[model samples]
Target: MTFQGSGPLDTSGVSAGGGGGGGRIAMGGGLGLVVTVVALLFGVNPGDIMGGSGSTGSQQVSADQSELQERIDSCTTIEQANSDDVCRLIATKNSLNDVWPTLMNGYTDPDMKIFSGSINTGCGAASSAMGPFYCPSDETAYFDPSFFQELTRMGGSDGPLAQEYVVAHEFGHHVENLTGVLAKGQRMGNDGSVRIELQADCLAGVWAQHADDGPDAMLAPLTDDQIASVIQTAKAIGDDTIQGSGSNPEGWTHGSARQRQRWFTTGYESGDPSRCDTFATDDL
Candidate 1:
């Protein structure tokens, strides 16, 4: 799953930030916490966790524009994305920009912010522990590349497709926002939350389906191994898998590992957005 050499990438929408010091918020109990423990447990909407407020006392960390440009410049060719992690993210973003318009009407690209440590977002201040998330209020996606390492630490594969799946999944949330499906997710209970997360997973698969379709496709066709790697990553991030021995399906917000893989496969096999309606199905 590598980008083609000819496709051009515009990383102007992305910025890089430096590390800053702050009291890291633990994942456990706190009513004042922006993202609730339930949201963190499920890995669902991050903006929902932030409670629609910007960081109050958190220190503001500015991105070094010159250094950010240097990183972008280094990824001048798609081939560079194949070798470098940051470049791969940039390349994937470009590809998503190209493919999404064809799938949905009135699609506007989301801004991407690459930060170190913690950063303030439209949702609120977020640490790398929150993983990659999309803030619908500002319509931006935030990522700490180090989260890729965290994914591997959590028993997920760190292969290229595995990484791309993460990026694509966040962008899928952007798609849900654009389609007005995200609002449905804001409703009460884990049922809505699980639907939202699983649909995003399906949407990620939809993107992967067409990622290498035509001559202009940025990536080469995915290999079987790459596909397997993505499935493994999806399983690793499942609520049950993450909760381990204390796994509780009744409290699950993101569905089980089998459900995640099945929905992703459905979108991949069908290559149709209509098939991704997790909310309509009785059996998710």
Candidate 2:
């Protein structure tokens, strides 16, 4: 990856908070973007990965956790951007803000929240255990840098683009919000639920398509291998793959890994929203 984003592009108005009134820490890298569809339908246990809740408000943290806050606020230099995974997360955030709405056609912009140990959201106060998630109530995406570490624990790749794919995927959920598809799909849980998640994966692929659209595209033109990397990630987190193996098939919500990769590739190769219609197809 050729580092792009440096400092906070729009941190001025962005409010910050800690679990224990320790102020807001940047907690950049460990976070991964997840969506509610994965939780409510997939049986993946959003509580296990999304962390905190919508009701916990913005006050949650420990004294020691507060100390971690200091490190998060620093200027993310290019050196750190290359050397630190957290910094790459920041890049992904910057990149998504740059790419998302352009693809969305018409939608409101949403803020990205990066937390370390734990944080609060419209969903509730969540610990890092729940993984990265987007809370519709706050209209903000929440992430804990340590989530990638958890992904590694699950035997997933920790590559930079791979991680960015996660962020892009969550931003895809925000797209769902603007499109009103999220609320509608939620109503169609189980069968329709998996399609929603796959659509988001397709949207994430759309982001990757233009990740480097600017004068200085951080990552190289997404190679076939890179595309495959993200596809592999989609597969690894699929409902069927997780369920069939260890994640309980009955609880399947996000679709099988095969479905995930298929949808993502559909978007990446075509880069057309029309092609991302998981709803029209019976595959999902």
Candidate 3:
């Protein structure tokens, strides 16, 4: 993705922090090697950002300003040449802010936590092993670049668009949380879980459609093949695809590969939230 910001940011030696249990780490510079782990945490269902299952109940996470700032500063890519990760995060938020308001009317922005090995969220303490996620308890998103290595191992290529797609997917959950649709769907069980994830996938597609239009957008117009690659990545992460048929299909949280592709295409083609109505469909 080609982010068209006022100009690239100049965060050459910035750090990620301002929270407890904080420490400094060096930033990596290579685009090919840089990774991001996001937590898509929510109520009822754990959103994709942190790659967990279920939501937050009554959890309290005390804020430690300097430490939190330290964590944010520490969450950087390898080279830290132009602060691309920070720029990417800011640009994505700008994009989400652009579209989500149309769907929710007055949705407030959520805090984004960038960490390396682990982080403290309103939901609880989480390590990179848990993956990227969104925490509903604090209405924030968490990410670690380490998980991109796992995605590469699974045959997925890491690109700016791929990373943007992941970020947009997590933002999708934040949209659902504000609308209460996520909680409503969660009450519906596994079927609800599948629908929720599919909708998030659809939401990501919606964001992708408008990504190139914004001044601060980091994505270029996606090709059909590039789109397919993203869809394939989505399929690869499907509950069924990840766990396989050997696992009980009925207990699946994310939808099946077929279902995920179908929903993603549905949103990609239409570019409308209405087209992502997993609740009205019985296909899953």
**Backbone clash numbers for all candidates listed:** 2, 37, 54
**Tens digit per residue, CA lDDT, model 2, 1-284:** 54554434333213333462222222322322333322432222132234332332333344434544454455346445556655665666766776766666776667766666556566555555456667677777766677777666555667777788887777778887777777777777566667778888888777777776666665556667767667767766766554444455444557777778877877777776667777788766
Lowest summed lDDT over 10 consecutive residues: which window, candidate 2?
20-29
After superposing all C-alphas onto the true structure, candidate 3 shows an RMSD in angstroms of 9.2
Kindly provide the TM-score of model 2 when superposed on the true structure, using C-alpha atoms.
Answer: 0.78
The local lDDT score (0 to 100) that residue 171 gets in candidate 3 is: 81
Model 3 alpha-carbon drift over 4 Å, by segment:
5-86, 214-218
> Model 1, 1-284: lDDT tens per residue?
46776555688788775443342554443333433332463254554444222332333344343455568677777888887888888888998888899998899999888776666676666666677888788888877777888789878898988898888888988999999888887774678879988999999999999999987789898898988998998898887787678776776778889999998888888888889999898899
Displacement of residue 158 (Cα, Å) in model 3 is 1.1
Per-model TM-score, in order, reads 0.87, 0.78, 0.73
**Candidate 3: tens digits of C-alpha lDDT, residues 50-128:** 3223322222222333444554455343233124555565456655766677656778877676665545567655555
Compare the candidates by lDDT and give the number of the best one. Answer: 1
Ten contiguous residues minimizing lDDT sum, candidate 1: 51-60
RMSD of candidate 2 to the truth, in angstroms, is 6.8
